[model samples]
Target: MTEMLQFDFMRIALVMAVLIGLTAPAVGTFVVQRRLSLLGDGVGHIALTGIGLGLLTGSSPVLGALVVAVLGAVAIEVLRARSRSGADVALALLFYGGLAGGVILTNAQGGGSSLQSYLFGSISSVSASDLYVVAALAVVVLGIVAVFGRELFLLCQDEEVARAAGLPVRFLSVLIAVTAAVTVVIAMRAIGLLLVSALMIVPVAAAQQVTRGFRSTMLLAMGAGVLSAVSGLAASFEYDLPPGPSIVLLALALFLAAAAGGTVVRRRRARRAGEVVPGPAGPGERPRVDAEAEVISG
Candidate 1:
């Protein structure tokens, strides 16, 4: 790690990785609670169009992605809130349309080659200016999470209840969407738009395997995210691998390890209590770790 950090670019990449690590999972906790795992992917696709726009206009791609992504996120949340039956169809349209638009715009600007870095990531290519943009955006995301964390968690747990409790469900929902969009933009330079969602989600999922409450899950996920990001960046530098894939793969590995360890621990507890060990949770089943009882008790 010390050897890798000796260089200027590596130091910048390390900072970018840590920033991305901390911010992505912070918002991701609410996203997972809301069961919108794919929301990040959709926002990322739309952000690509913003990247293309920036390239075409000779402006900052990060700024362009932030604008477009936030707009798209609001639209998504509004549609999701208003049209339960057709939300999936609407999101599909946006996803494909954004991707197509980005491709056309990028090719028009003759930036097809340069787009690869944003799509797949090039951590070593991250510049000082890019680091500043990422840091600013990350702070914005973390600030939103810190301020709205409780309301956001309630909204995710049950939007109707949040509204009944006098919380602005609509506004908070849109806020989460916007926060997620900013996170995507922050991570794009180091992790790439295509895979940024994994960094947001995988750590949260892994943390869920061993945690018993929303707050604990969020904290553990952030730690796991940081570990994955820094370790994966180091590995990529050492082995000449791509940072994005390396980071994502490491998160996945952590998830698998956590899953196995959690299962063993749960079974041992069940045995001690003379209770039956439960089978694996179904897709629709929220794990016992995330049960409302657990969160409330905690």
Candidate 2:
């Protein structure tokens, strides 16, 4: 820990991780709640083509990923709006196309020292300039979310109602999509393409297990993301584990613990409240009924 703090690269990696940890889950709560948990995955893959293009042109991969990810996210929203019923099909098509194109473009180009590193992340390789870009993007993404928090909550709760309430549902959704894409690109530096989606959704899921209110859940999820990334980075440095997967494992563990503990607490509360308490569901499952809510209602 001491040595890592002394090193600029480690410090940069930790800072980037913390920023992503906070930013990813903030948007991820809405993503998971809306059943769009895999949106980041598809966008991350699409961003790979951007990275390839950057490398081909001898530009920054981060720049490439940002532009491409944003465009891809916009395209997704456009396709969703156009197809309505076939949105999932369109997304799947985007995912595979992005992946295939990224590979062909990356290989056909002169190629970098290693594209695998980008796909899997190289947190320790972060530089000062990279850190600056990440910090700027993180601030912008978090700022957008902060400014429109209430609209986002309403939208997440139910699009129809949000629309009925004159909340500009389409605009809010597109805003979310663009923010989410920017978030994924930033996290891709620390978490990698394959695991970036997990960073976005898992911390939110863990927070959901522990918190009852949407507002609290959102805050807790961001906290969980930050803690997971920082602790995971420390552990990776101290124990010599790979950083990306290490951080993901820590977040997963938190989710499991939260799920089990929340279930036990709810079951006991239900029993005391004279409600029908069912057996705990599998890991990651939300209880069919909220025991505390039943108690309050009773």
For 273-294, candidate 2 gives per-residue lDDT tens digits of 5744456644555554465446
lDDT of each: 0.91, 0.86
| Residue 264 accuracy (lDDT) in model 2 | 85
Per-residue lDDT of candidate 1, residues 1-298 (tens digit) = 7899799999999999999999999999999999999999999999999999998999988889999999999999999989889998999999999989998999999887768888878877789999998898888889998899889988999988999999998889899999999999999888888999999999999999988789999999999999999999999999999899999999999999999999988777667545433346556777763664454455
Candidate 1 differs from the real structure by a C-alpha RMSD in angstroms, to one decimal, of 6.5
**What local lDDT does model 2 show for residue 296?**
62
The TM-score between candidate 2 and the true structure equals: 0.89
TM-score of 1: 0.90
Give the 10-residue window scoring lowest on summed lDDT in candidate 1.
Answer: 272-281
Highest lDDT scorer: 1
TM-score against native, each model: 0.90, 0.89
Count of residue pairs whose backbone atoms collide, per candidate:
0, 0
Cα RMSD, each candidate = 6.5, 6.6
